[model samples]
Target: MSTNSRWWFADLVLVVGLASFSGSIALTGLDGPLRVAFVLPLVLFLPGYAFISAIFPEAGNDDTRKFGSDKSEAIYAVGGPERVGLSVTVSVAIVPLVAAIANFTPWGIRVLPIVIGVLGFTVLSALGAFVRRWRVPANQRYSIGLPKLLFNSVGRHSNGSTTMVNIGIVISLLLVTSSVGFAVLSQPTGQQFTEFYVEGQNINSNTNTFYQSNLGDNGITVNVGNREGEQTQYTVIAVLERVENGSVTEQNRFDQQQVTVQSRQTKQVTLNGNPSLSGDNVRVRLLLYKGDPSGSPYRVIRLWLSS
Candidate 1:
């Protein structure tokens, strides 16, 4: 179709496609470099570019100023460099603004809400830009064949200095985007630790609801989540304590087990045996050790029962 129509239509289609793909990857729980690659553009470029397009639908003229009366009039279209620069800058601002607004809504700045808001804004902006661009005279409407333009610049020497400057800007923007993507995707070495806890039935079930008439009546499900970035060996020990007047009068070691857990995997150990407990406040404590149980416990969780 016409140049202006083609430009806006292509722009809108690209935005919609990218938004749909990125939203799918995020919502489907697909992660990795692919997700980041698709998502970074929406967050860093597309939204802002759409907005800038809406505001300045006419193509940039060589001269920014129009002289007629005593006062000089400003042109609506910005140059290539200005437009691209503004797109990146504005995109950065828009993402956070969308998130901030979503924070107050029922969705509360979650992934789904933020994605919907950004996509909606971008789609609307693209439509506005399309309409505005079409309204301009066919001759004066700003339009460019981006692939042809870039190809011509690189394939042959068309515009010498200007072409080089534009290329430089493109390269700089790519570098900035790549640097950000690398920083986000790179896995840095952080503090390594294991998550140890005691629950009732399931992995995260409330332990407070678990009470036993006798110490041996209930089984304790101990979960050891390995976050050491590698497979780890752990020792879990269950201790039965008889407490009276805020002091433990007697303590007995009931069960001990060794478990091996992979990085980011949780292993559950069930302690089902304990001696007969007799006291006002009886406590069943599960002490976790990294490797050996000879030293003090690394993590401790207790279940208290009133008899």
Candidate 2:
């Protein structure tokens, strides 16, 4: 291919791969199939590929192969294989590193933040790859070998027999397809929601303590967790009630709040209550309404706290 064509084509892999990855973030509601289509490749390999290309743009040049006799070529090449290997290794680590940092923020470990972080890295690396290639002499500019390396190796053997090679390719494709399907199925559907009692005055967090003074002073904490892939409205109502074996008596409302939680995040709402709720085996009920608190709750948590 011509130089201009090669440059444009080479750039497309990183550009489109990341675009596809980020686009999948919006598909969080679609679940399984979309996941297999986009998420895994971006998470597992694309970042590494981009970074490696940046540092070792020539790894895919005519001189090297990732396996067999050519495996050591990257080491012996002008850049040296060790540096190339390190680039590849660090590229892989980028995903987890971004995820760990994002988790501490409001984003958590959700699809959007992770994808954006990776795509940012991917774009930077792609730019580096372009610069690195641009400096190379005209004669040395070679096509990337990844496609040939992965797709071509499927069935060919030293002897190059067509029958065996064809069969091997078929088997390999089948395994890959099966693995992808399994991954999609095995991945947790980042859906559903959770409602739990939290420490007094902090609805967004769990204190794990029951007797918090805020629990009875017209103050209550209810945390609602949503992984529904979009902004969801929820109503949290804390009801103070007493149940007498096979009978119920005297229910009073202590606190109520309407709040919204982003997809793949948790939000806490501290409602108001009086200290009278303390002691006497009072049942503190936390009801989470998906859209309307007055309507049936999607989840309910009953906690018995002593003031």
Candidate 3:
């Protein structure tokens, strides 16, 4: 038991170390392939492995977990492939469950809380696994002997130059795999759309609060950015409205313009209005349409001209 055996020691240390390192990378907002590679295992494998290890700490037959049989007489353990499959399955279940639970909490399902939740669960499960393994007899407990066997095989052929070349090849393969995986995972797959906004007369002007008297002399500016994955033709219509008690009492069309913008480019349209609108919360509404302005507007932006 724990008095003499430490075979599970290294396994527990690796679990805790990986959890801490990945947690640090996430919390520090580090980005790129290295972070993705490290954190991927944390999310997809480690927690489930720790959970399974905690549940089954012995390296023996599957009869150990059978109901109603004598507990001490049998051991339930899994081989490497079975362990890996179980870990992935359990991790998939755990992550979403944790997220669902986090959805109700004050922190919601955000990065910080998820990292903390997963990290905490992993570390605690690892500790439980260690304790369970420690309580079992050394011969009956699960141990990672594959790495020792590999190390011994390498040591047998440790000629100076060949070993260095093997190590280099392995590192190179890992780096390449990590880079490709990150690229595939990080591709931009979001929806393509145009960005439309209203700005005051100048770059430094605030569009939210405008004086009605100065609007006729210095008109507002509308900017359109094409992120639609292609060149696009856009129609902009500007309207001045006077609203009293949440209802528009007077509405006047001010300006209309049509412009073509290339993908990843922006265009500005000037809207000048001479309508005699005098009141609090006078709105300058800009309607944006793609190609045809006959149907409903594709996007709408409003600016309040304060009295």
Candidate 4:
């Protein structure tokens, strides 16, 4: 599937990255794993590949690689000037630094923005490297040797001594690929309340009258763990209702709390004994919603504090 034996590896990586990025958007539920696969290379290898390319774009010619064998050998990666090593150091540090900076912004360490930033950086660096490489004379460009090592390490080898190194590279790449696959398959999917329960901590009961007027609440404390698949706004409404002649109506509204929660975020809201709803028959009803109370609830818990 590749034509350039020496630089086909880079082509394959870009192609696969494009495919994964597309799949993550189009495939609906299976987007998680495909995205993981794409992001690993974007963050880890792609930028470095571009940096290496810029440093040694013109050096892939075979004559330079086999210039003089036996003791006066081909330099593996350290063949270039001191600037090469300095460039390498800076290139390696750039992406992680970008990621740390990205976290401080409003995007807040999300996959989409991060993947976009890293990939964009990689591409721009690569284009600069390309322009620089083409400007140098062909014979002069032959001095850069890192490109020989990066994209076509195995095929470039004319001897058996470096077989072990090539094998190690293949094995390491496979292990990383497998790890991405595992991450995609293991990610949780869908939305619903992970946990919802009410605890009446400060509840004081005296002869059928359940009442509390503490600084926080004399009513139940509602805990919600929102594992609901998306970053969404939610409202928690707790109403103390009265039932007369087998008909129910709202009497005292305790908690009308509204919060915007992220996926897998946990929150706690209290339904206080604000006025201590009483008078023979009363029930406390709590509902957790995704957007508003008009929609169907993700969870509902009803308790008869006094019936």
Candidate 5:
């Protein structure tokens, strides 16, 4: 085959591979299958374009050359065997890297930042590809090659080292400003509390633990209103630890912590309901107080209720 033909064939395979890889990442990262439906067409089209390009090689050389020659074009030059090896290497390496990072990270809510970072990187990579293409000169512009299209759709945007340094400085300034705001906000603010109500009338304490069990029992069941205006019985599986001076001393089991109710009703059974109730109609009031815990320096809360 001629160099032109060889180049075209290589371009075609590279585009298809990239599209496939990007589609895989998108499908994996995203929550739903809807993206796959949208991406399948593009995936199919990449190879299809290659086939058509082979048949009609002379039709659109300028556009093709422009779009196909971006950063992705360089990666495609590594022969077929090398290309496969690169793919395998990336796939194998990513898992352990993620695992190692996660292992070193702190537990509880603090780990959220790391998770957000990973997602941000993926998004930024996709965005960067598009930004690069957009910044390219019009005269030097290329056709919509498959790899460019996929990366443009999926990667993050970043200026090279210099731009990144500037961005870091800007981000540091913003963070400093935010820290000042947080410090101002955190100082000796009056206590704030959220109130949730539980419907007492429909609640059947006989079958539920609230009537039968003592403190630190297995579970408590309560009834709350459902979407249809009918009352539905729900079981509160855990109890909230009492808050003293704005902090919860103990953690409750998962089952008794929160009661799930239908969206239609505004009232939710609080874990801190009254422990003493003899009559059929008993009102349970739960109060949740928030405060900072000792040593950890993290703010926490405890719950208390009266029936």
Candidate 6:
């Protein structure tokens, strides 16, 4: 057969071989073997095309006459419709292959090869077609270097489209993945806590000072005093309860009993819990450990009752 016919046949064989292998892998769900199977065909095809062209220099001569005829014109030789069409076909085919590979790997590693392969094919094909159309004279467009010329031309245009498409797809994928991850993290587990209260008293008179109601039942609020003009830290050790007339009520509700106080500074403490305070008189004591009680450093602890 003529060199041109041989070259075309080789191209057809390579394309068919790759397509068949890809389809088989997709159908059979064989990931590891597929990765290796793709390499040999690619290696063989390029050399085979070159060898065929060398043997039939007449075909190459024709390509040169047809495309190399123009050196000065700003030909849209790279991004022509035919090249664009081929690239689109390759890209579209890759999506399904990627999906199939992704089925095998939740991590999505398998999909990467498909994407790379598709992109490489599109780029190489476009470039080859472009070089063929541009470097050869108009009459000698079928030269041995035609493939290179065609690819070079098409490569320039497809690159811009490829970049835009790839970036958009990647960003969309990341957003979807992140949203799913966040949803999985927001589920609740069952748990409950015990009720308690804290009361404030005047150290001088040993008398009830500022009496506050149930601090645990609903929520507790306490005012920490800083007398020494320094920073202080307090740790709440226990919750105390008080009983009155006929019902029980939280006397002093301390959301935060133990708190660090800056010298001469005082802040209100708030705690969440169910305190039963529904009587005439009630007093609750909160045991506290003071640490650097005169410092401005403080950390909030969330208390939960174990039920």
- Top of the candidates by TM-score: 1
lDDT string, candidate 5, 133-187, tens digits: 3454443323334333222211124336634554554455446445544553454
Arranged by lDDT, best first: 1, 3, 2, 4, 6, 5
Better of 3 and 5 by lDDT: 3
lDDT per residue (tens digit) for residues 120-223 in model 1 = 88888888887887886665555655544332321123477767777887788889899989876675767578898765442223435235653467567778
Worst 10 residues of 2 by lDDT: 76-85
How much does candidate 6 score in TM-score? 0.22
The residue-by-residue lDDT of candidate 4 on 1-307, one tens digit each, is 1223344235434634653464354323333455555455554455655666565554433344544545344443232222233343454476677778789999977656665666666767667665765575544442323444433432244345555554555566667557756855566555344567665544333342343334234446677776655566878888777877878865777778887765556677766546456655676678887677887777887665533
Segments in model 1 whose C-alpha atoms lie over 4 Å from true places: 1-8, 60-74, 79-81, 105-109, 138-144, 148-158, 187-210, 213-281, 284-300
Candidate 6, which segments miss by more than 4 Å at Cα? 1-6, 32-90, 93-307
Determine the backbone clash count of candidate 4. Answer: 0
Query: Candidate 1 has what TM-score?
Result: 0.63
Q: Which rank order by TM-score, best down to worst? A: 1, 2, 3, 4, 5, 6
Q: List the pairs of residues colliding in candidate 1.
A: 59-142
Query: How much lDDT does each candidate structure score?
Result: 0.72, 0.59, 0.72, 0.56, 0.36, 0.40
* Number of clashing pairs per prediction, in order: 1, 10, 0, 0, 25, 78
Query: Which lDDT value does model 6 have at 128?
Result: 57
Instruction: For model 3, state the Cα shift of residue 168 in Å.
Output: 26
Please provide, for model 2 over 103-131, each residue's C-alpha lDDT reduced to its tens digit, 9 standing for 90 to 100.
Answer: 99897997678777877887777778777
Query: For candidate 5, what's the RMSD?
Result: 17.6
Q: TM-score of predicted model 3? A: 0.51
Which residue pairs clash within candidate 2? Answer: 74-81, 75-81, 203-268, 204-268, 216-274, 217-273, 218-272, 218-273, 218-274, 219-273
Per-prediction RMSD in angstroms?
Answer: 6.6, 7.6, 11.8, 10.5, 17.6, 20.7
Candidate 4 local distance difference test against the native: 0.56
lDDT tens readout by residue for model 6, 1-307: 1223324334434554565454444333232333335532332232223222222223233322233445422333222233323333344355466556666665565534654544355335534544444444444333323333233332234466755654564455446434544443333333211122334331212333233333434454555665432355666533444555655454444333455555444566665554544343444444444663344324222222211
Candidate 3 vs candidate 5: which has greater TM-score? 3
